[model samples]
Target: EFRDMKTEEPEVAPSPEKDKFEIIGKSTSRIDGEKIVTGRAPYTHDIKLRGMLYGKILRSPHACAEVISMDISQVQSLPGVKAAIQLKKGRVTYAGEQVAAVAAVDEKTAEQALKLIKVEYKSLPFAVTEEKAMEEGAPQVRKRPNVQKFNEYTRGNIDKGFKEADFVLENTYKTAVEIHHPAETHGSVAKWEGERLTVWDSTQAIFGVRDGLARALKIPASRIKVIKHYMGGGFGSKLGINDYTVAAAMLAKQANKPVKIILSRRENSLCVGNRPSSLQTIKGGVKKDGTLTALYLKNYTSGGIGRGDYCSEPVVDLYKCPNVQVEEHSVFTNTGASRPTRAPGHVQGTFALEGFLEELANKINLDPLELRKKNYSTKNQGDKETPYSSKGLNKCYQLGAEKIGWKRRNKRPGEGNGKVRRGLGVASQIWWGVGRAGTQADVKLHPDGSVEAICGTQDIGCGTRTYMATITAETLGLRPKDVTVKIGNTEYPWCGGSGGSTTTPSVAPAIRDAALKAADYLKKMAAENLEVKADDIIIGNRKFSN
Candidate 1:
């Protein structure tokens, strides 16, 4: 069953019935553009403290192994070794699993100290592919014996729908493992002050990091504050504090000094998260007229020894059909854990679904665009069953087709070729993030007339700072330059992390409301000065007079 997580509804402000907008919807320069260009922005790695020491981890060499013994005696006597820890108990699950760590005055010393440590392991049989892991007697990756579990989803009568179909198509598709190699490798600088822990982390979700650190350290959430004003990237990898962050905290506590740890590029490759590879089997039927009859799909995916579902989502209702069946399953393998990428499962699903549908269209002698338009659902068939708040999908498809002259596309592949083959493909997709719950914004107008808008969300190169300033300036009858937007701090009010495609629909209205409220306050002040009703005085370009 499709379910949407609860999200906040943006408050709509009453129109002031005025126009001549100065900023809203117009392109504007980013507030942090100068800092970015000049390399003046302070990222987490830029933090340096007086007693800070660098940290490095010694990782396992084998893909799958049992840690039999760990010796850190040589590492302890290294030139600048301050602290070291051996893997206390658990089995080494994957290559690069930290067997030990060392803190030193410098990275060179840290590197030397790490090499001094010794670890002996008992290697275990392993399977890298999802299919291999599923074999009857294949080496078990997870403690669970089997590699697959069924998560069947159904709607309507599939057997009858298949019976009515004139043609049926079945195919399997595969995607490769993808990494979220954000430019900024995962790093954390932890400094303890009595009971409080301050962390400078490179992460997408600072608030989530704070909570994760607090929980991992057995400290109250209030005692942990994570600061990450400028992050290189996440795609989705940096959503929360990883074990490395926690390890930095633990090492700092043991060393009794500030500790900084950044995963080396090699370690980052194995430890950082990625989009898991998936195998999907699609069985679909269509009529001679290009109408869909039944759609059945099954998905199996591996997240590198980690467990999570990676299904062909939105499959339950991507297109309209009388009968549909979907089963999503996940299994563990000796690979990196999966994390959300740009569109997560939807991008992969669309690639397979759209590609298959194009083939189906060819077999049925129908235009691909026309074929998709025929199956558009009036309501969200995949989930809440709610009518769309608004749908421009048909218009989008039509406009795109017209602009691209899709009618001229080679109907058959290999029809036009010399050295380069020319084949045109069309794909349709939908993302359903209206917004998330609990976002607050505060707008204030300075005595000198400049306005400030504050929300706890990062820009992440999405132009959030510019858009917010524009929204505020437009509402207050001012220019974008007259407004300021502050963000990327947990100290500010709660706002969703800037990951999903919901930022505009989520934050824009709040900015407008805040600007309107600030204007109302100014109007009240102006009414007293102009000897007229508050509503009679209109706010305009740096002036509050009626």
Candidate 2:
């Protein structure tokens, strides 16, 4: 019923011809599969510390408002309440913004403390929809215009290219905002030891949180240890330091006890980041011979207070067209700032671009796949001169077409009518998945013959620990279960966040490097003992031979 596909784009820097891997290319179970399925694995939500207090935050109900008067003195005097603080002093950006926080002996007491704290806010005009935000004389989301142009790119002449075209097509596509509801809601457990802080968070980035917490608390990075051994999920929501984590830390410091804060499902929906909605219009021109002549895209996306998704990368890079133009705008609205969703801009952009291309192909009585093949690009993105060293997209298209029986697809839209219907469509996207040069890992060989591979990379529900064990064990001539993989800690060698599809590429190389170095060291030690050269040593099956 299913087929396993293997493919890759060549590495930027290829290594020497390597030996056949015993464990890597074989069928292997996840190293921690048992522990996870048996409920023995510890996640941030499962973490509990001694003298732990529950933290609760009071949030603004108004989408746009300025805090007029706030008092936490009553909350501070509440019985069983350990600490209380005013989180926001002036204007609140969005409805779920933290206005105040308190830590109490229990969840009931914490909830009671939030009710005792009173705050007054002056509500302001606001817009929550893209159409409403883009209207003229709209209530300002920020100092800048509500509809602010963020990106513009042009390659070759747009007018000339359109003039030369035989046929043209134009259409608009829209995507709604998407939210991440992980099995375990966002939470943090903070414990203080004098000036040092230790926080277990449900996050995708350990080092990022550590550095962020260090800056927020105005303490050295070395004093904060952020750990995330396991997390339910965080498509992109947990990539940075969250306000709740900071609130937990502050509460713990004031209470002189550990603090834990786990958000409710409602809180998760209101305050946490989500994928920004995109409205894109794509216009394209193609020749009679199925050659793409020009492409243009205008997109408007919203990210509340911050903007990051451009929604034009696919338009500029996914196809081969000399005359390409793109204009992107961020329509600010009163909502939670958008975080990077899985593939972020590419998802919306590709949907629009691919659908547009399909329409262009239908207009010319040509197959969509043939049109794509006709304009296959070798240059890097839209560059006229530069070339990517590795690209296997065309091959993928062929493999996919053959496997899915492309000929079975309908010739026109809505070609069939039935209670159950299936449609076959093809879509392609250009992704930049590469390693971070700054990523680092550590391999430690203990005196008792135990091995450990450590990094600050969070698991992010992606079997990071399993692959880490596999790589280290394969390199050191051991089994995956034999190598203890320790990750998700700031104390380990620093690694970048697990976003942008960079975790595997960034981490695999770093851990392999560390393991390879350890292997080389072992070779030298064995050769020195045997009075032989290091190159003559052979390592396999946990044995050294000369």
Candidate 3:
């Protein structure tokens, strides 16, 4: 008794012709360009509420310490102080860990209040770098082990593959830790009305913050409303809830008024997340004909007191090889935890893998691009024999080579005759860009012939609002100006947080479906009014007729 459950028709293949779209791919001005250029667009930093108090956090100055005593009596008794909280009174694993927080009438008063509070600490030995952390007898940042095996993958027999190889090469590569510094720093402004809480945040994920607040404050998710009309940037650091947001909500409740807490530049650097540093050693065996025989990778990375990024993806899947092995280790150190930066693991992994491949090609007397083409894979080696939905790497290589005049490169590496030497190099990258499902949207057709599209996804400054408007207008046979796009509010249809390049693909289809349903309804209505079949009705030029 099995029945097919798919209700929607298969999507039509996209046409490469730009003329197929009325608004897409055209040289149109940004919808919000005027407001942004005129300095009239409001951002989270511009939020202000009546009777609002400013909040500041007190952080540990030592890399590692044990809090012996903390006295906040003087801070609480400050003239302009409204609420104070002690965040930590026990072991502190890293510098900049929040020890306490204070809310006052003004920023100056809050700074003064922070200084008035007293604390005594016992310094402990700490390791700030991966080299020092992995050394024997090093101060342990975590209780279990300083260096722990994080992940590993193996396929086929490496011994057999290496035996058939004509050449083998190995080298170690290193990448430094990077910090995420958005134009506007991380912050939050929280206000409570009765039991309902409203928050204006500079973040990538609103529902993430909403759920985090619910768990932190022990309240229902429905009682919390997170809003971010405009944000400067997030990259990846702002994808999750921050402690400052929770502290602001608590401080507001204690003071019985709204509270605004924005991290200072220094605070943002020390406390917020960073891209984990990676040290990868890759070994490759290749035949004289440029076919890859075996690939092996050993990665050591650190995310401070947290986990490390997986930096072996490129070695495992970027090329075709029967024998592949990868092992990753995440070491703990006395520093800030890490968050996803741009491409996270794949960027660092590709750097090492591609460089190794190029060196291997040189040893085999073959062109680097030619070697890659010889080992081109149409299936994802990592996921068994699953064929790729689309494989365009070979075409990309051809186009890129033709555009760059690759033949004009120096005949030999570094064969220049000046103090400054020149050479041409190439690299490759692979990552997941598929969208997640379970997104939704709504379209409303007004009696006056105007249309509106609603969704809860944030724009994140990628012209998402413009995309919705364009899709809706194209579906309704109306001008983009005739459609109003509403987004960045939790009260609308639910949408997943903006990250992993998921927002556009996920929201566009939902908007298209909603618009299609609206169009169907309008056609049926027109058919009833004109005494004709629905299929005979036509919609164009802002009118529906038979």
Of the candidates shown, which would achieve the greatest lDDT relative to the real structure? 2
Question: Cα lDDT for residue 72, model 3?
Answer: 91
Query: Candidate 3's residue-wise lDDT over 1-546, tens digit each?
Result: 000111553442233256766666666566677887787877889999999999999999999999999999999788999999888878899899999999999999999999988899999999999999999999989887899998999999888888889999889999998888999999999999999999999988888889999999999999999998888988888888898999999999999899999999888888889888999998888999998889989999999898999988787887889999899999899998998887788878988898888788888888898889888887787445788999898999999989888887776566789899877777778987666677878888777777889888898888888888887887678877778888888887888888878899888878877776777778888898898999787666678876
Local lDDT at 367 for model 1: 83
**How many steric overlaps are in each model, in order?**
2, 0, 0
In the predicted model 2, the residue pairs found to clash are: none
Compared with the true structure, all predictions reach lDDT values of 0.77, 0.86, 0.86
Better structure of 1 and 2 per lDDT: 2
Cα deviation at 384, candidate 3, in Å, is: 4.6
Total backbone collisions, model 1:
2
211: Cα error in model 3, Å = 0.3
Residue-level lDDT tens digits of model 1 in 1-546: 001112433333375544656555456778778988799988877889998999987877777888888788888787778888764455777777777788899888998998888777899988777877788788887788636665777887888888888888888888878888878788899899888888888877778888888888898988887777787777888877688788888888888889999887777778788787778888888898888888888888777776544455657666777788888778677776777778877877777788789888888878888888888876777433778777888899888888888888887755875888776677888676776666677787676766788877776667778888887777778777777778777776667766767767667766666667677777887898889999788877767766
Which is the better candidate, 1 or 3, if ranked by TM-score?
3
